[model samples]
Target: MKGKVLSLGAAALLAGGALLLTGTANQSNAQDLLGVSFIDNVKPYLEFRPRYEYVDQEKTGKKDANALTIRTKIGVNIGTVLGVQGLSATLEAIDVSALIDQYDPQRTKYETVKDPANTRITQAYLAYKYSNFVFIAGRKYVAIDDHRFIGTVNWRQMPQSLGVVAVAGKPIQGLDFLLAGVYERKGIVDSLNKDWKMDKMPIVLDVNYQVVPQALRLKGFAYLLTDIHNTYGIKASGKIGLGNGVTVSYLGEYAKQTDPYQKDNVATKPDIDTDYYRLKVGASAMGFFGNVMYTYFGNAGGKDAGFSTPLATLHKFDGWADVMLSGAAKGFYYGMKEWCISAGYKNPVIGKLMIAYLKFDSDKDPGFGKSIGSEVDLLYAKKLTKRLSFLAKAAYYNADNGYCISECNNKEDALGKNDVTKYWLQLDYKY
Candidate 1:
């Protein structure tokens, strides 16, 4: 009975198009086009990136988590395919490895890390575009504006994508539409039951139009979701620019999800309705920096208006540590919520350095007097060259309760002194 679960919707389409992308798919098209391809309209480019990290996971029994990742991408955008074409492929192949023997000599006291690395083909797809429309088939990428909902699994050693056929068209001015028919079959190993009865059928429909394009900078959106897990939601966002580089942005969402039933047609008791909203405003002076953000989650999880489903993108608003996707994937998080205020200074005049700071606060659980969590973060990234860089980050969390979840938890140290520290460095290359 212990196995994995995969969701396959009726139309069977999986998401890979990025509207708000994280770091990985930055160089999607072809800026590195060579000779004739640039002139003949067949653009070709390549990228090679290598990342190395060392983490000290206090609860894993081991003293460190060290590994190396090598990412390679070679793609071509052909102007004419069989005498007719306009499309491209971004990433071709990638591999990850753990160099267990290469322990840092400066830190002789630490233990060796394990080899938990993996390898796989990340992206391989073809695209076709005509004046006001775009079409993609095979394995590609997807991220919806800030990764609020579905995004490419770029954080994994071997992320996931679908065998998809999608289309984008502007049906009218100020209005656009997207539709796709995705492949639904799963590999036997990935399909928990190996029955392949098509476990997921997701039909996504989203539209955003400039509501106030002139005097006020604002927009409205409607998202319709249907399938394996029956549900739908509405979201809207707007921004106002105060004079002199200052601005405010607000976002809100409400989703009502029914239950995923077993064969008996029995509905899971107390289906939940969830709502989340965030309002943040900040100012910019050159690249020197500033920001303030506040987010709130509903109080109850099992009933209506509370917790959100797992694998759903919450990092759309906050930073991506993926620390929140824990729990029953259906339970409520205690406390009102939290706020984050961050600011930073990029490369200094005297030294080549970048540093940032984050201040956090804890909110008391709905009806209780006890606080949940509070923390601080210090991050720095330095460029060795335009193509290579290194990063060092630290986090400090002060929590009074047992902060435990399925992915990451603060349960190992029940003494409440569950403070944590983490740091890492990496080298990158892009072409």
Candidate 2:
């Protein structure tokens, strides 16, 4: 699911560029642009990561079967620092497809979404930056350092999240602070068939202090999640650094949600209160880093004390094999608890190879009721040169019980779980 194209976004950038180059570029306060006289400044960026893979899906589901997949993205930046410091903007578009093989005449969205499905966007935005603060008003990426609790959701073929107006400050040499208000910004057009369930406004605050100069760092998060039907009290995270390229982090999140229109089936109970927390630790040094993490979510989002991170980040922590990306959230193994331990090895000459084993267990019931599963993944990533790179990946997921999500969780459709085994090769370039 990787490739690149300008789509119609370039047109808008060019139009905006003409406004800047002709109208504002001549401003006496502005700097020369490439020795070329212009109205506005224009810069383009391209991100392409295409993959070829073999996939096997459980035959129990008609739509779940073996196939191949491809992904791509393109972006442009227009506007200038001439008239005003905050007078600039950016544009981005992406395309995704899947099929039995390149030889197949038809392609699917994300190369995985069954039925004739695809996704497109005009992620455009304008922003102005001055001092330590910036204001963005468009569908741009919103990500923090580790992305454990909040992220831009960039790992998927159609990565999505929200737009935000954020302010940051550096009062001291080693300290930094941030405050932001998030707005619902996912591509709204593609989700019209169903009532697009979205949050109202989520507040995020973070602060980082450099304790031992560059040798150690500490960070804290207090995310206030609230919507019309639910309110997540607050979420927290702490990161610490130990000398010698080693770092550790922890998470303490709690929340509650109550919605009668929260599920597919009409027969579900409302969660008066669902509170849970997790204690996770991770380390990476030189050529090795592994993480042992766990989570406990209660009827927080729906299924009475279930473990799913609505505001939490499911992208950064997982093995990247995608076994737990979607369906993992719809399963019941979360009622009790879940954990994973993963590690990696780096070979400077070739690339970095990683392996991980993830297991989800539930005690609410057994044998076809609520169950546990295991997944194994091995992958390698390498940059062939400054602008080109490649990745090779393989994985296996064994669901020793009923459909991973159907029996254990209600949000099954979003997460496809039919015991899958897959392999893929991807090529990427930067421009």
Candidate 3:
């Protein structure tokens, strides 16, 4: 099915390119091909990333996993759409291939890496800009602030893209807004896995205002995932200057999740009434930084579910091990709370070095203990050249009392609570 869909898309794009060439044969402009003008300008880009990942689980009774993958993207940016002044378009495709495929893409037998070999059109969008507003239509990457709700999960070899029609603009000073209607979700996984859930369309609205130039900012957002769920939230952040080249930053956010408004009354969905909260404080001075954060996902037990950010870049928050990614849904049934602290340094020559520690626990104990686990994450990133970079990162998780309930008597690893360690080495290049 995905192959058929991709073929149709490729054919359409080829047809469009042919039409552009035909139009250029009849028109004339400054920049010409074979003494004939070809629209305005064409800019092409290429990117390549090769990564090696290793995963080890303490007590899964399965062998350790190793994966080597390469991701490549090729795209072109058209300046003007067939001589239209404010119209432009971009089209791109991506491919991911595996050399050592020992890990499972899905978390079944071996350790999961989730980087499967695949190829698809990653981005294809048309944009029209007038004044301060831009209108966009097509398949593209749509990311919200902080990526707490909706984002392009770039951590995966196959980033998530959306099919949307959106309008973004700034009508007043220090204020910006985006309104979009989403029809398709091309997630990091394959289409056969139900990753492209187009059953009911979703609507999104995001507004941000700068209350003070560099001191305070406010944001409000709404996401209505029809037949699934709905989320509404507000966030406030600020930065304070503290004397000699030092600054302190803080953030506070709160949100509510509830049952969504179904497009059709075919089948009733699970009831949901939960809350989400995040608080953070950080300080930076002389290329050194430190931060402390706490996040909460409320518990709605029984037949109801808790707050879950299904569209968010889940790997960024909670922990790098991604144990809490589904803990708030049904894996834990009691939701989760996390406390984290991190410190880092950055330099032009030394690049960036960061380390973080996180402690996780359930909001309410369900028979067993509330102790979920703790994790330590380390990262180092360096730019080797203007268009090349290197990165090394690792995560180690220690399950304090294991993540098991009364159901699993002696098999504590049944809930995937075994000690896990993962590391990666990668190089990225772009032209």
User: Once superposed on the true structure, which residue ranges of model 2 sit more than 4 Å away at CA?
Assistant: 1-6, 15-39, 61-70, 78-82, 97-119, 171-178, 187-189, 192-202, 205-272, 283-286, 299-305, 311-336, 366-370, 402-417
* Model 2, global lDDT: 0.55
Q: Between candidates 2 and 3, which one is better according to lDDT?
A: 3
Off by over 4 Å in 1: 1-41, 87-91, 101-116, 153-160, 180-200, 213-231, 238-256, 260-270, 303-306, 309-322, 327-336, 347-370, 382-386, 404-417
Arranged by TM-score with the best first, the candidates are 3, 2, 1
lDDT for model 1, please: 0.44
Reference-based lDDT, each prediction: 0.44, 0.55, 0.78
- Listed per model in order, the count of residue pairs whose N, CA or C atoms clash below 3 Å is 25, 23, 0
Ranking by lDDT: 3, 2, 1
**lDDT tens string, model 1, 1-431?**
01100111101112222212332242233223421222124444445555555544344354554555454444444444423445544435444444443432323455332223434344556677888888887655555555555555454334445455678777667666666544432211132111112233244455656566522322233332222233455555666667675555555555445443321222333444545555655555555556676765544443432444433434233332323333213333441355777777665432233333322222323322334445566667676666666556554555444332111233342222233444445555655
RMSD of each: 10.2, 6.2, 4.5
Per-residue lDDT of model 2, residues 194-277, tens digit only:
222234355667777777654456666555544313333344455577878777655554544344223332345344344455
lDDT of 3 by residue, 1-431 (tens): 34533553463445245434555434543335334333357666778899999999886687787999888776778787756788888888888877788888633467778788887888889999999999999899989988888888899888988888899999999999999888777888875122223456688999999999879999999998765578899999999999999999999999988888554333786577878899999999999999999998777655357677877887888778776666532324466788999999999899999999999887777556777789999999999999999999999998765443213334343364778899999999999
TM-score of every candidate: 0.67, 0.72, 0.88
Best by TM-score: 3
Error of 3 at 236 (Å): 0.1
Q: Mind sharing the TM-score for model 3? A: 0.88
C-alpha lDDT (0 to 100) for residue 416 of candidate 2? 35
